[model samples]
Target: MSDFLTPKATPETAPFWAGAAEGVLRIQQCDACGRHYFYPRRFCRYCHSTDVRWTTVSGRARLDSYTINHRPLRGTESLSPVIALVQLEEGPRMLTNIVGVEPDPANLVLDMPLTVDFEPRGDMTVPVFRPASTGSAEGTR
Candidate 1:
């Protein structure tokens, strides 16, 4: 395993990290505006409401954009990571990694369906995405 840094949770982000540890993706939802947001802030990004509460969301997303990292990080010289931006089903976008497929433009299709998968980093589990289609690793356009 690579020596990747694990996220240290603050009071505002503890619930999100806790949910990820249990294979659940949690985001903050504004009770006032009914808008969901990510990055685990105390207030809603859309409406700036303090009445935001953490809720579990569908682990489904769409591939919005990405780049293949040809130069691997230290201790991961053999791996070319796919750094991706995914738009969640609930309408928030997050920066995550695409895994279980080749890091090539031919395989990374825009608007491709994705499903969340967790990977262990140090003691914490972080969210990564894989193609939603079964029996194949390549993304479908």
Candidate 2:
């Protein structure tokens, strides 16, 4: 009873998604310069170094920008996926859909901070984002 949109991942990005299943956010970090990146790659795009390794992040980011997509489509009507672009705190932007939220202008606020959560897909875990707590002593930026 679960037919979710499964993203095609390659060797470069597979570890990232796999980590999500274990409740971790994996991003590539330059072993030489300590620069972190998203959309996992073999080489560091920042310093062009092959000395890159996947590291676990805090599973946190911010809503850089988003759109409230109301257009309904087959297979997407029931879920109402909110397509969005998020900016990770480590300094990279990624295209993903937010979950556990209504796709509305009032809900998708620009520059609103967020944190990552995982959704179970058959045999895999996908990373979704949600509003980050801004009030708690542990959540304050």
Candidate 3:
């Protein structure tokens, strides 16, 4: 499904969407403390500084936690979803969906490695994660 239905975008999230549309997966990095952050914002959550700028990320992440949702909702149709928390290599954890895999809990767990992939929703590209890169494995970051 398209990300337009998931969450509303604001000015703070505009650049993020813009970058996603370009397959760049831009994330916020604090210029002060050199810490990276997800869920796009203007201030660094750690340092309390407004010295934040958009920076390109490798989109490499690990599966911090997740749940396979088998129930259908009003908006979602036939496909079951894997609601997940992706811990990026830069220390920021992001709430996202796990795509291109079977939605099974045993197959997904804490600290499992992950990598990012873009699913096109109209003109925007939403970042979805998959199993971590295994070097020669398919969809490796």
Candidate 4:
């Protein structure tokens, strides 16, 4: 197993983890404000409404920013991880790893389109992003 720490699902975030296990990206939406958010909380980040529900998203996002991590977790040292912040189609920004491409500045362009994919960490699955272009080389990690 990798030395990377996996996320522990809580009552509020259980749905998100369950969706990822099923290869679906799930986030929370506020019924009252009609807005979506991430990090799994009981109330909406925008409107502070407790009428939030879990919903599956398109898994499409745009690369906003990133940093190439030369030093990764113990077992994942072979994979130079690209830590990225992506803006989802629903307007929520999520911190995820950019995969399916080289971990270099030229390859990690700003505003590049991305699609979600899951990576197994221990017994849990986590979301990762890949370049939208089919021509890009397959994921290195």
Candidate 5:
């Protein structure tokens, strides 16, 4: 009875979802062009070759941009989400949610270092970001 949206894993995205379910972040890398990409595709976006493979990423990133969503969709009103664009350490930018901190502008700073965290939605685990330096005696930078 969850209200969150769950992604349907396809042949091209099954590995990525499987990794996520196991608490790992996976991205598609183009074997031909040596470039990495997100949102799994059947072919390499850069080289136009069917040479893409799933690789586990470091789960580290920088907060590129974000918005605090106060207006929620139907059945999601209880959650005030922080939607964000994060640039992964491996060179791909992904649209994800920021968690483990306040959703206000005062807390969500640009270029803040982040680490991935997963939240279960239906049968899938969705990736979300958190302040990388959180939980340390020294606060996040």
Candidate 6:
């Protein structure tokens, strides 16, 4: 077990974490409905079919929403991470941390183009996002 706090992986979520460890973003796509979804599951949220398969994604996303934490959680007093929901390019939204930028509302614009980055925590790797290096800030509301 790792000293770092992390979500316990169920069988369904293992592939996601495995892909993260390899620096790849992974999600599930429903073969039946042609919709992509996050938080690995046995069935598709759209079609309710068991035909979902793990797929690698571009790791590019848009910041759908976020909140900056000035207060640190217990045992993590030295770090303040930005909690955010990002809409993946493949159209799935997932909870993640926003990194490589000031954790302020003025800097964390909604719909900002973002790219994935990973941090190793004990036995697991966590995916985080940052503003895309080459994109304009315009319309990133």
Candidate 3, 59-130: lDDT as tens digits? 778888888777767557533399888888878888888887788777887788788877765555678888
lDDT of 6 by residue, 1-141 (tens): 337676667899999998888888889999999999987889998889998899988888999988877777676653437899999888989888888888778998899889888876667887888888885443122
Ranking by lDDT: 4, 1, 5, 6, 3, 2
Residue 31, model 3: Cα distance from true site in angstroms: 0.9
Task: Summing lDDT over every window of 10 consecutive residues in candidate 1, give the lowest-scoring window.
Answer: 132-141
The residue-level lDDT of candidate 1 at 16 comes to 88
Q: Candidate 3: global Cα-lDDT?
A: 0.77
Tens digits of per-residue lDDT, candidate 2, 1-141, equal 146565666888889878877877888999878899877889988898999998877766788777666775666664436878898888888887787677778888888888887776667777778888766433212
For residue 99, give model 1's deviation from the true position in Å. Answer: 0.7
Model 2 error, position 7 (Å) = 2.3
Clashes of 5: 0
- TM-scores of all predicted structures: 0.89, 0.85, 0.85, 0.90, 0.88, 0.89
Better of 2 and 3 by lDDT: 3
Model 5: per-residue Cα lDDT over 46-98, one tens digit each: 78999878898889899999988887787665443999999998899999899
For candidate 4, write residues 13-35 as lDDT tens digits: 89999999998999999999999
Error of 1 at 51 (Å): 0.5
lDDT of each: 0.85, 0.76, 0.77, 0.86, 0.83, 0.82
Query: How many clashes would you count in candidate 3?
Result: 0
RMSD of 3: 2.6
Worst 10 residues of 6 by lDDT: 132-141
Q: Please list the residue runs of candidate 5 whose C-alpha ends up more than 4 Å from where it truly belongs after superposition.
A: 1-4, 78-80, 134-141
